[model samples]
Target: MSSAPSIPSAPSTHPAPPAGWQATFSEAVRLQSENRWEQALTLLLPLAEQMPHEASVQNLTAVLLAQHGRLAEAVVLWQRLLAADPGNVALVANLGRACWMLERKQQALEYFSLAVQLQPQDPLALLNMGAIHQGEGRFEEALAWYERVFAVDPHHVQALFNSAQLHADAGRFTRAHELYRRVLAIDSKHVIAQAQLIFTQHYLEHPSPAQLSALARRLGAQCAAQSPVFSNWLVSFEPERPLRIGLLSADLHDHPVGYFIEGLLAHSAGKEVTWIAYANNEKRTALTERIAPAFSAWNEVFRWSDDQLAARIRSDRIDILLDLSGMGSGHRLGVLARRPAPVQVNWLGYFGTTGLPGVQAVIADPRCVPEPEEHWFSERVWRLPSTRYCFTPPKNAPEVAELPALRQGALTFGCFQTLAKINPRVIAAWARIAQRAPQARWRIRCGVKSSEEDRRSLAQRLVQAGIAADRFKVEAPLERQRYLASYGEIDVALDTFPYPGGTTSAEALWMGVPTLTLSTPGMLGRQGEQIMGAAGMAENWICFDEDAYVDRAVALAQRSAWLALAEQRRAMREQVAGSALFDNARFSRDWHELVRNIWRDACEQVISRSSQGISGPKP
Candidate 1:
């Protein structure tokens, strides 16, 4: 979304217009001030044509046109106005914004550059420039622009939020958390910041599950207050009719969530279910093409408003709606909050509870959400027969290579998790293991190649943890194929605690490399433990504490232990390949049964309530 502010409406700032036209222009401006934009536009259009050379009339008309989504027309009008007064910063900024809305990136940047030169203190111009740089993956450049914005206005919420997001993305969660806190202090109801704060808590020191749940619940309640829940769905409770299951998510492409759901979508359901996909993003990948056919119907709901999407689901008579995105990226929790379907379940995309009252349950296996930890979630813990996750390996993945330890003369321990999860404690544990097993090599994928600052910071932290600086190296992130193939270079993959590697751990196992996991409290922590159990790896590889984790990792890197792991890693991959993790047919049966039974159980409850003259409560 374009962040450019509208042209300021200060009449005194402009030159006096011709005598007879003053009242008419004043009336138009008055209408705009009164929020009657349509009336304002109507009054300005004829005046704009009659007084073709009038800067005030033309600029006003262009602003109106831009507000009405006529970006091309607005751009032309602004261009003409700029030719008349080339140094007008407002005109320059407005033109830049119109070009941006039209997706003319280069033109927008040029005009924005002039706007900044004309008025270096303009907040809107700086913000837009930051957004463009951030979009292009120039993180440092984007941060520089945001820093300029902060210098001008420390309370600038957008700049603060954007910078926080970049920090979070680069795995500097502590800094991200600081910025998010500042934004919330300025504006308590900032939705994105609230969600981001919830997401960031885990990456820091151990965050209590209850505290996170409470925060998520607040967000859920906030969304629920937007629109009233609907409860008048009239449908036949037939046990045999095909259940209409609607899936809402933005990650329908080749992402971590996409990989997790691939097998479930591919599993044939025959007539037992009708799958409808609500892809919340426009950019689709080859993985998108692969999953499209599996759905009975597909709708690109990216442009759909919450009410519009909820109405569509209600109109479609969807029996069950699964929220795949939860509070993660591209989540439309508002639609779910409106209770668009009879039953709503939180699924694979997010590991934790959604904390949404609209969502009835969270899909998990017994191992993922063990009986004792069931209270951690706001939603009911609906346990699957085995593992809740099923995998579909990437088509481009190479065959598992022989373990590098045999030929490389020493074992190498690696962790390719996102920088955000490698907290201070994780760094300390890894340092301990590195120090104990001095002959073993360490490669920690901190983030992108440009994340030099983060790598340097991590390196400093490792040294602080008592490990020799020369014994370890912080590596740059790898491309997908290379990242997967690079796994064979290591004897063992070390999982990060609290927010352990989910997709990374799975991929390492697929590449015939085993991961040693340490259990921690929250939902995200359980993923590593669960994935290891699902893959039928050695249970001894999972440690209960940091001390155990360090001990187990060092023990695995010993000469004899490393020698034996060459064959164990290959066998581990075979185990994962043969396990329920990739069994699409078995996963399909279990998933469908779960969905079917959940709806049937819901329908029966509604019927029983109706018979007893009691009202069924909204989820």
Candidate 2:
């Protein structure tokens, strides 16, 4: 009877449905579906208040908030919704994504793990976990997660592509190539996969001109058919306006890229170019501050959203956007894709193609991207006259005055590249060299901060090769200046195989330390050979099989006179200084010419469009 006591008759008008709440929510969902995140957020807030307990609505509201970048608020809402429906895999995944957007790595990992546990076959959760691991530099762990994603869903193109990148990073080019091929097989129009496959093929010393040409054709066809709108927004032409050249880099402080750019900055005094530095990497030091004054504006873009940073660049009307991070750590290729400036160029960072359609050109030397190899790149190759890349030694780098004398009793060999560069083959070769020169001590300087595990692993490798523990020395990471100074303690720097040192090799030469490198066919692997060739030490540039590389290293270590020649050491340093390696003026001139050419090409397109009364599609 009480139940039958008339469930109060539903209100006739329902109070006119609270002023556009449904309409607003529908509009919000429409905006969200269109990926117009900010507009969705603007409508979502009041709609969320009106439907607080609607699980789907709440979940979507949180996601919308996160998309608008209100991460903390989004997290709170997600937590509230998860509390009610704790087993909701989608909600958990969305929360995890928001956590990642906020850089709450551990929280993100936990939520994503929970989502995966709840739905073992969820590729999104697994993929997100892989991304988190990749961001943290745990590429192998990332690869495992990506493999799991692939196992659950073979059509997971992102997982396949990411696995390829992880394999490439680990120097497992064969596996990477297979993964890239899988991606291409799935979607022939997949530009990234196509570009990466071409790059990996070239990297593994398997150049395919046909593949490169096909890739170019695909890109050109897409550009033509879609009529992609390249931004024409120009920085005001101040004829006398000091060209505001913005250099965006994650390694602006004391990284190798920083070291190379320092020399250029040192030589840029009184130039018309006003440098704008965007330091995106951590570890700001006194050296970074010292370099800051050389720039007209120095910003830390990590604090800004992609749009905010893009807007800042547009507002500043940067004449040239020089990206020093080419698909490396903390690279801002996404921002570059927005076409932040009239001219964008990749220089001194990534050696290969960026595969970004927006990049106008890649700065390189004729030695690297020779005319015959022009088809290999998505962007035009701008060849520097002498060397596309240059090395700038620290101003206060100590002269190796008498340090060679200390090596009379024992020859110390050094390699300062990362442990990641020390592939199993590289270690094996080093072990062979160590065995040949019993009196020589092998010193490996890993660029990463020292860890007990790193030391133990390295020691195990050396011991496995039948070398005594006492024969090997592992030095901790050093400040840029201290690292340069540490080179003084070594007789010769042994370059790694299949992926040789770039900055480290140049640094060694600049510090009066000779580097002997074995040239590999891959462009990245032969960087040391190129640097040494430019430094006028091609005699020291050893191109041999693995066995011969070891033999050369041992021979160089055993010859005491060769190691102790003060005159020769001084001459090598002088040659490095005078050679194309340190000539900033020549680099600047080359850069200017390339920019002019790009401008001319762009201007011609604009002229053609104007004459035809044709406006290209918006990007």
Candidate 3:
């Protein structure tokens, strides 16, 4: 009776309440539009509960759940929506994205393919498909998808940029250059495209110091204007506390970035910094195991939803978040945008601006970010004294063999990089070198197995360059130890242009195979030049234009004695190993300084926030 008396009002039903469910839904939508996601969720949840049979409500709920980092719940809700409305392309696309976040790549691809089929002209669909293919290392397939996006929306910046990168990676300099130019045409101030163009031009023609400096100045100003300095942003910080530093990367395992990071971790072992690794890759390898112990905590973040990952980093009291996979495959730039850390830096893995607003600094060396050209980064340039990155060969690495002894009379010119690096222009240059030095036989080894498709593509390219497939020796993927040993068979390793081999060049040098590099303008394109300089092989660093690159290749190939001095170079390898190329201690000191600076700045920000009685947002 008391309960009945308390519930006696029940009067709103007669007045139909102040507003209907639709009005309440609209209010919730407005809250969502204002980015008050929690408020929106609170209001929508009740409405959704009342309208469980409504597909639109369910879809909206799913989206809200996704935004709130309730990915599993969102996925279930999305599945229910899709079951009710299987023909919804938007739902399919969203579901695909969720699946991708969940690391259910196959399911994501199937959904994406269906969405693409349904919305053939949809740029987003094409981009998503392209991304999936790119992640799978099916560059050609990714290129096709990106091309379709470009065909539909010619000014699609991402598609244009990514396609250009794909072309550059594939060694299609002409195509890559054209696409980069197209991007610039659309937005001349596009710093990345401008840098890439300069890089491409440098690959085509090694610019002199005057040219490099001029380009560097222009790039510096552009970068400075674009760089994100935290001073201008309204940043809130939590109280001073034990700082956690999270590093986000797709290359946490046996990649160039991994090689560079080894020394830094070992040096930081006793430091106050708490290092956390957020690996965004699915393929776990021995290198992963090797690197895991270096971190205070290692997380495979590829499976976490972006929001969830961001929340986790925030919860860890991370002060500085370093993005190592800047725009590279499996990058979490979206999460970075959420401002998971008080300060974020882009370093090591990417040389160019991330074009993201959240990153605070980009770690560079004086050589990479020369004083006059410090303006090209979107983040403030944090210059390391020696080098921004340092390479270290695995312990117990094999000894380099003399090429003269191994090659017999046939000179073997090798390029042990991904096939994608062997662009048409590179193939042509190598062919010209081969034509010049008839005794030289080319040996190409890519990390990818010599699949029939790869063989046909490469063979077609070589054939077009007037080189017979029979004259070329192609090898399949090799293990790290065996891969290093394979370089012993080479007289010299030919470095790629526009996107020169970084770790590959260092590894080649470690194996006593001198690498010949063509220095380009951008840091990304001239990495080989940098590595060679660091390795004390500046003479071997071929600073040449395209024509000169071929000429140099021919000249180096003709110097059979120098090329044959594998034993002498082996002595040099020891020197190179002792040099900055593999000097982990020196590199570690540089890294420590750079990170300490970042951490100090973050700590100051925390202090400032606390003084102002504005506690920093929880991670």
Q: Top lDDT: which candidate number?
A: 1
Model 2 Cα lDDT, one tens digit per residue, 1-619: 0110111122233222356566777787898776566677777777777666766667778877665557788788878777767778887887777777677777778888887777888898899889888877777678899989989998899999898887776556788889888998898766566656655554443344445456544654453344333365655433344577889999877677877777677667666677888777646866687778888888877645555677678788687788987646677655776777767788887766565677777777756566766666677787766676777666788876544635467677888976656767777777787777887787788866434456567678778877788988876788767877888778778887666788888878888887888876434655777787777777745665777788777777665556344566767677778888877666556666565565556556556666788874112
Decreasing lDDT order of the candidates: 1, 3, 2
Rank order (by TM-score, best first): 1, 2, 3
Evaluation by lDDT, superior candidate among 2 and 3: 3
Q: What is every candidate's alpha-carbon RMSD to the true fold? A: 5.9, 7.8, 9.4
Kindly report the root-mean-square deviation of model 3 from the true structure over all alpha carbons: 9.4
TM-score of 3: 0.69
475 Cα displacement, candidate 2 (Å):
7.3
TM-score of each: 0.85, 0.72, 0.69
lDDT of 3 by residue, 1-619 (tens): 0110011111122222234788888888898776667788898898776776666667788888887667878877777666656667887888888888778888888888888777889998899999888767688889899989988987898899888877776556788889988998888777667666655444453334345445535655555454332232233343334556789998887777888787777767655667888888766667678778878888876656656677778777677888887645567655776667778888887766665556778887755666666555556788777667877676677876766534467667888877766666677788888788877777788755344567567877787888877778776778778888887777877888666887888788777877888766656765777788778777745665878778777776664556446555658677887888788888877676677777667667557766788854321
Maximum-TM-score candidate? 1
Q: List lDDT for all candidates, in order.
A: 0.80, 0.71, 0.72
Candidate 1 lDDT by residue in tens digits, 266-347: 7765847778999988678888999999887899877566777888899988888999888787888778888888789999
